[model samples]
Target: MSGNGERVVFVLDAPGDESLHTGGTIARLLDDGADVTVLFGSATSYDSDASAPTTASAGAADVAAARAALGETDPAQWRVLAGEPQGAQRRAVLGEAFAQAHATAVVAAAVDPALRQAAVDAAGEQGVPVFLSSRVSAVPGVRLTAIDVSDHIDKKLAALAAYPGRWRLDGRVVRLIDGTEALVTGTETYASGSGPAQPAELEAPTVGSRLLAVLMALFAGALFGVLGTVAHQTTIELGSLTIPVGLTLALLASGTLLLGLRLVVHDRLVVLAAAIGLVATVFLLSLRSTGGSVLVPAGVPGTVWSMAPALFAALVIAWPRIPARRPTA
Candidate 1:
């Protein structure tokens, strides 16, 4: 979907609670041109059959009305399944649905424990990742990712309006009731393992944040450069050969630091900032002082130290960006 071509399936509980919890994220996905399919589960009881009917119940109409309000005009994008099956039956039904949709990732609400577990199990069997809608909790081995849906807050609110019985809109705020403390928010958080359902391209950082990153990178690079320069001269006598272990370690540390920034920040400008600080520090230290003393003497170790950091910086800055791969069925 979009340029990434990912088909995301959302298995949700009731038309109101689960929808409110993930409406903003749903709207964002649809806006991104991703192929989004929503499967709304039956709230009343679990249907035992593997092949449940797709009949339009009263709840199904509410789901349709909500989808329409959320800008999901395409009728085929959603389906109201007849039952919420349990045990192996539930897994089988959900598994078949996921396979049919060829879902790259599944977003399941935690409102219904059975449905949530079934979705997770089905997705795991297919090797597809699952995202659970809820606040970040300490789940061992799971990574938490928060999506900023502030841009689609209005659409989410509109969708919530469909369930007037549950949510009440008071002026600009949407609350659970007229005097309740619970309210809807613009940000939606989810927990996943390995690949979270983040946007294909993250939103660009604000100018202020970018500037802060650059400044921090520059300072960190300068600090590392100073430490490396100080320790680059130490040598270890191993039998007949003199091993410049300090020089090797220093170079390795600088390279590792720069590589980490490139991989984590995913920003060339920030990397360039750090590189400039490191290379500039080494250059300054290499120059002979007015009193005729030099920190980095003219030698093999000095020459390598002078040039290695700049080369490492160039490689990191020039490295091509690779798109993340989602697990396949």
Candidate 2:
């Protein structure tokens, strides 16, 4: 297999008249079954009688030469475009050319920094791969490695082609190696967006919170215990009738029900149940001590004190799983 999809190699003339380098690259790409486009400067004498030099005349001549070179070529296989002096204009021209050419890869001379930067930027915008020629001499039978510092698509493709079996493409980075495992890395020049955030793990309860919760539960339990003991000890009378054992049982049962609700239910419901139970327990206990009179009111405050521990535990358990706010699609 020839790897993934169809590949197109772009060759542009360098600043120092490096058309030979560009031509060699084009030939190699053609041999590898890649469609090739050679964008040469108008100053070259391939067609000597073309045109003379006025700013307007030069631009027209360059455009004509590019058109002539690309004419009669298969739309699927090859194309050519000329570069302008202005960076923005060049970028716009190259962008349109790459789109029209359906170029999959770019191989341009690395000698011109401005042109190289422009080409790289255009390739990125088009989502095409790029390869930069290095100054180092190529050793016989040794593969050339392209490093992807920025993880751009063009650089990765070049690295894949140049190193083949000895290359690894990771995200935006490509790792290239020789037969002996010796490496030369090239930096990619592209950017990808950030990934999603990960969820956090739940942590153990803190010493202080645990201690406070326990103390609150104990305090509530102790109040009920005291009331039970008191109701057992005291006697009460109402309208010529004696109520001793019944009042004691009522207070004990109320306390038990509240305690059970607090343990079984969630925190939100715990407080209400705890309050009612505590009030009943306190009133019954007070009746035993005060001869069945309503002088000492039910201990409503005691319910709050007793429910504190349960509330704390509920808070701790629910905090870690709190729902996060999701972004709008």
lDDT of each: 0.74, 0.41
Best by lDDT: 1
The TM-scores, one per candidate, come to 0.56, 0.31
Runs with alpha carbons beyond 4 Å of true place in candidate 1? 1-3, 44-60, 136-143, 171-173, 177-181, 194-249, 254-329
lDDT of 2: 0.41
lDDT per residue as tens, model 1, 1-329:
24157788888755565456788778877787777888766643222232342232236666678888777888887765657666878778888998999999988764556666777787888888888775312344333466767788888777777776655776546565434434667577777742324322244689999999999999989988998998898899989999998899999999998999998888899999999999999999989999999999989999999999999999989989764443221
Listing every candidate in turn, what is its Cα RMSD in Å to the true structure after a full C-alpha superposition?
12.4, 21.5
| lDDT tens digits by residue: candidate 2, 1-329 | 03235455454432112221232333333334555654432332221123222221123333333223323134433223443444677767766776776877765443344455566677777767665554311223222343222222332234233322333545434443322222323331111111112111123456776556555544564465445534543456788986567345635554554445454432423434344345444444445344554433445433432343345334433443233232111
Candidate 1, residue 126: Cα displacement in angstroms equals 0.4
